[model samples]
Target: MPFEAEEIRIDLMCRIAEDGHWHGTLGLNVDAQALWRLGLHPDQPTSVVNGPSPPAWWHTAGERYASRHAVRRRHDGR
Candidate 1:
């Protein structure tokens, strides 16, 4: 099968931990820079043999939570 790639955005509810790590519910217009730093960049493909599972601290909680805030916004709606 043939696949075509395109740019996309991601969103997340993020927080910095005391240990200097991050934790939060992942939504999806997540900054490419942030994603790249976190090892979650879509442009760079990865596999389980060499990479870890998506961080447990950040994940989709459920259908309802995911549905609520997984979008990219140009302006702050916070």
Candidate 2:
């Protein structure tokens, strides 16, 4: 089935861990059907692969994290 185009917004918050690693909370606001079409479930965690050269926004506080990490979905929060 063809997927419908919709506007989605995601917000993320990053923090430095005790080991100096970066971790964060990701929030996604999208339609459930749209998410399914993208092979993603609203109740499961999702992993993202960062390329060698990512956007400048991905880097913060001299820390370049998110090389490859999983983001969990927040029920009743998104």
Candidate 3:
């Protein structure tokens, strides 16, 4: 089985707790970074992203986006 790799973006709101660690959430009603991807999959239930507010910009890590992103499972790309 051959597979190709691609990247995806996701956003989440995180907070520091009294335990001295960071915590994030994707639940409803929060200030999460929020998804701005294309190919609407509203029924797909996002397990993973918001990238390139325009879907054509900042598609690589070299741009240093502050948001969290998902990459190919076996990818070693930068």
The lDDT for every candidate, in the order shown, is 0.51, 0.55, 0.42
| Candidate 1 C-alpha lDDT tens digits along 1-78 | 011133334466878868786766655444565455446667766541233445454464544577897776543333
> In what order do the candidates fall by TM-score, top score first?
2, 1, 3
Q: Rank the candidates by lDDT, best first.
A: 2, 1, 3
Q: By lDDT, is 1 or 2 better?
A: 2
Native-referenced Cα lDDT, model 1: 0.51
Each prediction's RMSD over C-alphas, in Å, is 14.1, 13.3, 13.0
lDDT of 3 by residue, 1-78 (tens): 011122333457788878777766654432222322432346444653443343334445535553565553422334
Tens-place lDDT per residue, model 2, 1-49, is: 2233454667898988787868788887777656554446555455632
Say which candidate scores most in lDDT. 2
Task: Give the range of the ten consecutive residues with the poorest summed lDDT in model 3.
Answer: 1-10
TM-score of 3: 0.22
